[model samples]
Target: MPRTEPRVRRLAAGLPAVAAAAVYGWAHWCLAGPASPPTAVAWLGAVLLLVGACVAYGVLVGGSGSVFGGLLLALALLLTVTAADQTASRPATASCVVREVHTRLQGSLGEGAPSQKTVYRLTLDCPGGYPGELKDDRAVAAVGEEVKVAYDPRRRASPAPEAETSPWRAALCAVLLLAASTVIAGRRPGPATRPRPGFTPG
Candidate 1:
């Protein structure tokens, strides 16, 4: 066997998946052009697709923490698509006041800070608006602070905060997540994963 580094091969494999994600994002824009309803199916599909990618990556990695990166990658992908989808379809914008903030562990983090960040629930006050749950990294948004929220015109109850995401950030994270997925896909299956003889995966 030509000892090919799994990392490299995984990355190579991830390129297409990343591109697919991009295509889906763009298609979302096209389909939703000129105003379109937020399809629950689309949201569910996006969630499943991203989650599937992460699971695939996790399986590829195969280790004690079998699905480490996969879960985060899944979330990152889901949120990215959701955010892009909203932005593409003329997401309804409204201002809201932060009701409260709570910390949640995500994944890796930068230097001198927690790996997780705080999530803020805001009370949206706008025509045809309802309270919503939103989150942003610690770098932005303080508890009890007023901020602008973007959400589906049809369902104002589910809001995505502007501070939670931006174009550049989304693009950057997409690429990073793809790369991480690849890296994770390259690991060997740990002792934790082993099918005994005549035993099924289940």
Candidate 2:
């Protein structure tokens, strides 16, 4: 019995890692496919599955460090899946008229007087029922000008002239979070000590 206990514990500890990997693989397969854009229902289902896996791992591991690490792992998986989805899917295009244009200065107003970049927000009206606003650093269109905007009808998010989706930044963050989770989950709890015979409560 004593020899079997250690093996059981080792197997339990490995379960979460396996589960996390499985969830990541499933998400990539579902979201990063070259088929039609995934529906809102598909997205919701994937998110729920990912959350359930993380929660199950946390509960099974039964440690503060493990729980926290599971959370970090969940976040990393979410980012990675989202980046993959955005990178793989193709967006629909529509011609929109720029209704209004607003500009704002972004960056630090510091002691050294660093240069601030201008951010442009454009309100657009599209014939394809795409009524949304877009914000970007470049001034791509002027008021009353017609410009082409790319959008995902499934997401119904604000359309933009260009889809600036890249997986590198999100992938980088995911890698860092995954590393932290591995380090934390691998940590063993400190040894417990009993009070000495002469020790008394303070």
Question: What number of clashing residue pairs does each candidate have, in the order they appear?
Answer: 1, 0
TM-score, per-candidate, Cα-based: 0.54, 0.57
Tell me the tens digit of each residue's lDDT in model 2 across 1-202.
2344344345445544565566556565565445534566556766777777677556544467656667777777776665565465446877888999999988744322225889899988888666477777688899999888777675423355665656688777777766666565445321122234797757
TM-score of 1: 0.54
Q: Mind giving the per-residue lDDT tens digits that candidate 1 earns over 118-198?
A: 443334344444545564544244656677776656552245666443456665665566555555554444233444569
Which runs of model 1 end up more than 4 angstroms from their true locations? 1-12, 19-38, 59-66, 82-86, 89-114, 128-152, 156-165, 186-202
lDDT (C-alpha, whole model) for all candidates: 0.53, 0.63
Q: Which ten residues in a row have the lowest lDDT in candidate 1?
A: 1-10
The stretch of ten residues in a row with the least summed lDDT in candidate 2 is: 186-195
Clashing pairs in 1: 62-189
